[model samples]
Target: MRQLVRAAHIGPSLAVVALATLLAIADGLPAQRVLLVALAVLAGQLSVGWSNDLLDEARDRAVGRSDKPLASDAVARRTVLVACVLAVVAVVALSFACGWAAGAVHLAAVASAWGYNLGVKSTVWSWAPYAFSFGGLVVFVSLADSPPQWPPWWLPVVGALLGVAAHLLNVLPDLDDDERTGVRGLPHRLGARLIPRVAAAVLLAATLLLALGAGIGHPASLVGLAVVVVLTAAVLLGRGRVPFVAAVLIALTDVVLLLAAT
Candidate 1:
C-alpha cells in the first residue's frame, strides 16, 4: 500500500489539481464544476504517474533507482499497472461529465502522456506530451463553464514552453541514467550542459510572452519577469542547484501571472 501510494507521485499529481483548481476559480466556475474538473485532472495525472512507473519498472531496476517504488520492489508492477488502468477509466468518465469538448481536450492530454510512456519518451518528440497535457489542462478547465469560452492565446503557449522547460529539467539529473537505459529524447540530443540554458531560456520566453500578451501596465508581471531574468543569469553563471532553483522561481512567477491573465 505504501509503495502503491509512492508510485502515484502524489506531490506532482496534487500540484496538477491545485493548478487546475486555480484556473477554475479564476474563471468563476461553479463549485461543482470546479470539483468535477479537478477530479478529472487528478485521475488523468494518476494514470500518467502510475503508467510511467509501470513502464519504467525494468529500466529503473536496471539503473538501481531506489527512489522508484517499483524499481525498489516495494510495490508490485502488476499493482501499479492495474491502478493505471482504473485511473484511466475514471479520467474518461469524469472528463465527459465536464462536457464533450472539454472531455476531448482532456483525453488528448491523457493520450499524449500514454503515448509518451508507450514509446514517445525515447524519441525526439518527448516534449510533446508535456506540452499537450499542460496546454490542454487550462483549455479543459476554461471549457468547464456553462458556456465555454476559448482560452486566451497566450495561455497554451506559456503552458507549452513550460512543458518543454520541465522536460529538460526533469531529464537533466537523469541524463546519464537515461542514456544508459537507451532513452534519447531532445534533451539528450542537446547534451547535458546545454539543457539548463535552454530550459532557462524557454522559461524566460514564457514570462516575456505572458507580459507582452497582457500588456505593459502591470508592473507586477514586469517585476516577475525581471526576477526570472536575474535567476536565469545566475543559472547561466553557475551549476548544481541553481538551475532547479531558477525553474521553481520562474514557475512561481508564472503561477501569479497566469492567475491574473486567465
Candidate 2:
C-alpha cells in the first residue's frame, strides 16, 4: 500500500486535485458539480503519476531508485495496471456526469498525460504536456456552465505559465539521472544555468497576464501573480530550496484566489 501510494506521487497529485477543485469553485460551480470536478481531477492526476512510473520503470531501476514501489518489486505490474485502469474509469465516469464539455476536457487531460509519459516529456517541447493538462482543467471549470468567455482568458494563460514553471522545477532534481538515461527534456535542453532564467520569465509572463486580467477587474487573478513574483525573486537570488517552497506558495495562492472568488 505504501509503495503504491508513493508510486502515485500522492502529494503532488493531491495538490493538483486541490487546485482543480478551487478552479471549479471559483467558476461558481455547485457543490455536486465541484465534487465531480474534483473527482475527475484526482483520477486524472493519479493516472499521470501511475503512467509516469510505469513508463519510466526501466529508467528508474537503472538509476537505482529502489524506493519506488515498482523498482523495489513491492508492487506487481498487474496491480499497477489495474490501478491505472480504475483511475481512468473514475475520470471518465465523473466527466460524463459533469457534461460533454467536461468529458472532452477529461479526455484531453488523459491524452496529454499519456503523451508525456510515452515520450513527449523527453523532447524540447516537454512543456506541452503541462499546457495541455492544465488547460484541460481550465476548460473543464469554465464549461461547467455556459461556453467560456474571452475576458477570463488570462486564467488559462497564467495556468499554462505556472505549469511550465512547474515542469522545469520538477526536472531540476532529475537532471543528472535523466541525461544519463537519455531523457533530455526541455529542462535538459535549456541546461542548468538557464533554468532560473526560464522560471523567472515564465513567472513574469504569468504575473503580467494576471495584472492585465486584474486591471480589467478580475481581482482574484492577482493573487497568483503576487505570489509568483515573490517566489521568482527568491529563486533568482540563489536560494537553493526556494523552488520547492515556491511551488507550495503558488498552490496556496490558488487556494486563496478560489476562496475569494467563490
Candidate 3:
C-alpha cells in the first residue's frame, strides 16, 4: 500500500484534485458533478504522475535518484505500469461521465502530457504539451456546466502561459542532470541565465491578460497584479531557490484568481 501510494505521487495528485474540485465549486457545479470532475482529475493526474516515473525509470536509476520509488525499488515497475494503465482508463471513463465535450477536452489534456512523456519533453516544443494540457483543463472544467459554459478567453491564455512558465521553473533545478541524460527541451536551450527571465515575462503576461479580462479595478485583478510584480521581481533578481519558489507561488496566485473569476 505504501509502495502504491509512493508510485502514485499522491502529494501532487492531491493538489490537482483540490484545485479541480475548487474550480468546480467556483463554477457552481452541482455537488455530484463536482465529485465526478474531481474524480476524473484525480485519475488524470495519477496517470501523469505514474507515467512520468515509469518513463523516466531508466534515467532515474542512471542518475541514482533513489528518492523515486522506482529507483529505490520500493515499488515494482510492473505495478506502477499497471497503475498507470488503470488511471488512464479511469480518467476516460469518469471524464465522459461528465459530458462528451468535457470528456474530449480532458482526454486531450491528458494525452498532451502523454505526448510529453513519449518524446516531446526532449524537443524545443516541450512547452506545447504543458500549454495545451493546462489550457484544455480550464476548458474541460468550464464545459461541465449544465448548459456548457466557456471561460473568458483570457482564462485559457493565462493557463497556457503559466503552463509554459511552470515547465521552465520545473526544469531549473534539474537542468544539469537533464542535460547529462540527453533531455534538452525549451528550457535547456535558453540556459540558466535566461530561463527565469522568460518565466517572469510569461507570468507577467498571464497576469496582465487576467487583469484585462477581470477589469483593472476588480479585486482579483489587483491581487493578481500585485503577486505578478513581486514574483516576477523575485524570479529576475533572486538567486538559488528563490526564483523557483517564487514561480510556484505565482502559479498559486493564478489559481486563486481563477477561482475568484469563476
Best by TM-score: 1
Q: What is the descending TM-score order?
A: 1, 3, 2
| lDDT tens readout by residue for model 3, 1-262 | 6877887778867976787899889999999999999999999989998998898989988888877899889988899988889998999999999899999999999999889988899999999999998888888889998978988888887878878988887788789888888999999999987888888888888878888887889987997899789888998889987877777888778778877877
Each model's C-alpha lDDT?
A: 0.87, 0.75, 0.87
Off by over 4 Å in 2: 146-151, 216-231, 242-262
Cα lDDT tens digits, model 2, 1-262, are 7788788989889988888787777777789888888887888888889988998899999998877899889998888889998988887887777788768876787789789989998899899989777766776777765454222676776677778877887787789989988998899998876776687777667666656655626655655566666776665665566655665455456445534543
Instruction: Give TM-scores for every candidate, taking all chains together and pairing residue i with residue i.
Output: 0.95, 0.88, 0.95
Candidate 3 clash figure, as a count? 0
For candidate 3, the lDDT comes to 0.87
* Model 1, span 1-262: residue lDDT tens: 8778889888878888899999999999999999999999999989988988888888999999999999998888788888889998999999999999999999998899889889898999999998888888888888888898888888988888877887887778889999999999999999877887888888888899889877766887788888888988877887777767777677778777878887
What candidate 1 gets wrong by more than 4 Å, as runs, is none
Mind sharing the TM-score for model 1? 0.95
